[model samples]
Target: MTNVTYKYATVLVAIQNLRNEGYNVDFNLEENCLICGDNKYTIDDFEIEQVYRYEGESNPSDEATVYGIASKDGLKGILVTAYGAYTDSMSTAMLRKLALKND
Candidate 1:
């Protein structure tokens, strides 16, 4: 597994460590996929290789998650998001695919 093996004290540390290990690109969620700059990848075209979730001891606002995403065409990146009550504003088909992946 290419997952980060050590426990990072914070989200920032985890991101920096992951980047140092080559998960350099940053991804944004799209309607039916993930996008990094002009490049896009559909649900079936990319995989979430690893996931890391962090929560603050005193504040829910500090919740965050990081996803290691890799595309079939060889692009590698990370997607950072808020943890609780977050919603994916994508089509039903795309949403279903992502949901199944989480399970």
Candidate 2:
């Protein structure tokens, strides 16, 4: 993973910036993997290239994170997820994979 710090005004802006840089695919979190269209990728199939987090000014529900992910097969994509109280439920492995970076 790239250990560079990037600052964006909002999660949308971060996603847009990543999209412009060739991370076009949109990935949704599944119980044990990330899904993009018909393709499913496990943690071992992809790497987190970058991560951007946004904390709400007032409501904790507004907290979110944007991830730049790249698959071993050359697929590049973005994954947007909520944190704290609104986090998605997933398998233990999936949670560990994402939570490690979240910290």
Residue-by-residue lDDT tens digits, candidate 2, 1-103: 6733449999989999999999999989876889899989987999888888788899878888888999888999998888653245677777766763423
**Model 2 superposed RMSD (Cα):** 2.3
TM-score of each: 0.76, 0.87
The C-alpha stretches of model 1 lying farther than 4 A from their native spots are: 1-6, 84-88, 91-103
Output the lDDT of residue 33, model 1. 74
Superposed model 2: Cα runs more than 4 Å off: 4-6, 84-88, 100-103
lDDT of 1: 0.72
Instruction: Report the lDDT tens digits of candidate 1 across residue range 1-103.
Output: 2343337777788788778878889988876678999988887888777667787789988887777778888887888877533364777765554442323
* Cα lDDT computed for each candidate against the true fold: 0.72, 0.81
Model number with the top TM-score: 2
